[model samples]
Target: MAGAVTTVTTLSNEARPKHLTEPRPVRYLLIAVALLFIGIVVVLPMLTVLLEAFRKGWSAYIEALKDPDAMAALRLTLITALIAVPLNTIFGVAAAWAITKFKFRGKNLLVTLIDLPFAVSPVISGLVYILLFGAQGFFGPWLMDHDMKIVFATPGIVLATMFVTFPFVARELLPLMEAQGVQDEEAAVSLGSKGWRTFFKVTLPNIKWGLLYGIILCNARAMGEFGAVSVVSGHIRGETNTLPLHIEILYNEYQYTSSFAVASLLMLLAIITLVIKGLIEGKLARSRHGQ
Candidate 1:
């Protein structure tokens, strides 16, 4: 048996194409190139943000964060994420469940719509809201008559955010839930579990990791979004400026140190998000292996 196994292994190795079976030196070269590319493109920029942020000193960094306008921007960003993330999470789970676990007409169209945000630019996403709610827009007169503001306001900001970050959770859950299929769900139903109970007890537990992963990515994008928010923000400093907008304002006004300082916060957020994502991925891999 051992001899047969060895022979098969050797034959499989020999059967691999030369290019597919990379030599030691070639593998090392490829790894080195990848590392170099990542260092220059990602690592270096992050380090620069940190270095420039602290260039003036720690006191300046703290002061930059403490500025009233910066504080407000932070608040608005948090509020936006708080509103957008949960709504998207619900929508994502529902959309994924519908598409993967059931047969329905226009399912392909629904899937395409979920990917619309990714295909469209963020700026365009924001502009879409403006066109729908701006002073001269179709609903502009109605909104004005009712004394309501949607464009260039917090509501508009949230709407634009929801539109752009729409795909993350659904995109993540779709493949995962599809791969999982409905066997477990059908089994749960057979065992006397009702619809919601089956979902909460079986479906949720199964897709929890992927769902969390998607939420993290969604939150990151929601917080980091600039283009769409920028168009509808009206640049109203404390009222509508998000962190990204605040950073741009500071930078354009020649406040390099403060701009980088604000940028550091975003950098830190991105780093934390990446760390959490990695941890979740590791846990997910372990869970799948165990299963």
Candidate 2:
């Protein structure tokens, strides 16, 4: 008994790692490489944006952001996100529910179609819209007769953003909802719960975190989207330009500091998105642990 107790104490006292630990030099080299990589890829660009934005002065930066064109871009971007994110959120939840809960033909094909935007180039996606709606394109004659504008307008911009952001929430929720199974939902139904009630009380609570995660990604993509929106937006100054497009216009017009100032807003938005997403993930982790 004493011998067993001594062995147990010795084992308990040993601070052995589960895997073979690297040498101090190797471990340090890995950490240095990671830090250097992050500095080069992430830190440097952010620092550059900040420095350039303030190069002229705080007054200059503020003035740049307050420009009429910049203000329009900001407003258009907010409106676009306001429309696009919620639309996609609803579609994502519905699509995820149907795809995860129902047995249907062409299921894999539906998933692939949902993810098709990711595989397609953004520039090409824009071109496809233009072809379908441009003045010389397929529906152009009919639209002209009706005096409808699709390409080079707000509608086109919203549509392009929608296409790109479509898959985010659905993809995030699918696996999670699948893992949760339908047991709870079926039980809810058997207990005389209505369909909407069953969904809100059972399904929504389970996937809300994943849904929020998807929304964050979708909002970021929608706001920062350039190539696709650019193709159809016509970059018509205060009329159609989104923030990224406005930054390009500023840069081309030789207003480098002001352009950087606008870019800084985008960077700030990205940081905020990341912070919120991290908080949501931390909460989810803690809730799972408590359960």
Candidate 3:
């Protein structure tokens, strides 16, 4: 009887609404629209950056990159990202564990605070730090009295990057950790495993992909942060200027090729970010199905 029913179901499946690989007319229309939008919105700008960078030829592009200020800006950007990404990654993990593993008062409020950076403008993020640390500002006198400079220095830049990228890892991990449940962790505890050991051995493995996804996001934002970094960097030549600020300085100096060349580095970063995000997301999807 089961075989007979299966044969009947297979016979019904042999009928086609459309070919197995084919889309309906509506689907085709949607696919075309999506492609066209991507072309206009994403592809076009990227092409423009590449074109502008090489427009004045290889010598110009090389020269642009070789500029002392440009080199310094590039270094500063990388340094900021290195500092910000790790700190944020640790924070993200701790926040996710705390919020997802424990039942506590004001949990919702804590989650909202984690998302504060995403909701606030990057410009505002930078400005808030400046208000607190800028000369003639809140802590300005004390900081100056102690000869500590943050408002327009490396520390300020790092702080701004941190503020903007703060949410990425936590946001990425929260839902995933929640979905993963705490059963394994609880069991690990019952077996005499310590908290740190359980986290490193069990929780970390389960959430590795999500955590990496968040780290990538955090790194990208830290490197590309503009509005906030701009507000705080003070554009002091090589000393305080990050890449985005360097690009602005070049543009203002009428070094169009140099500006675009520097800008192209950021564009490449964005592309790499998208590619990595896609790969991680694919892995995540596969793992979900495997489970």
Best by TM-score: 2
Candidate 3 residue spans exceeding 4 A from truth: 1-28
Q: For model 1, how does the per-residue alpha-carbon lDDT over 160-210 read when each residue is reduced to its tens digit? A: 999998988888888778878899999999999999999999999998998
> By lDDT, who's the top model here?
1
The regions of model 2 sitting more than 4 angstroms off are: 1-19, 286-291
Model 1 lDDT, residue 178, Cα: 86
Total clashes in model 1, counting residue pairs 3 or more apart in sequence or in different chains:
0
Model 1 TM: 0.90
Please report, as a residue range, the 10-residue window in candidate 3 with the lowest summed lDDT. Answer: 1-10
lDDT of each: 0.90, 0.86, 0.86
TM-score of each: 0.90, 0.92, 0.90
After the best TM-score superposition of candidate 2, give how far the Cα of residue 91 lies from its true spot, in angstroms: 0.8
Those runs of model 1 whose alpha carbons end farther than 4 Å from true positions after fitting are 1-27, 288-291
lDDT order of candidates, top first: 1, 2, 3
TM-score of 3: 0.90
Instruction: Itemize residue pairs with steric clashes in candidate 2.
Output: none
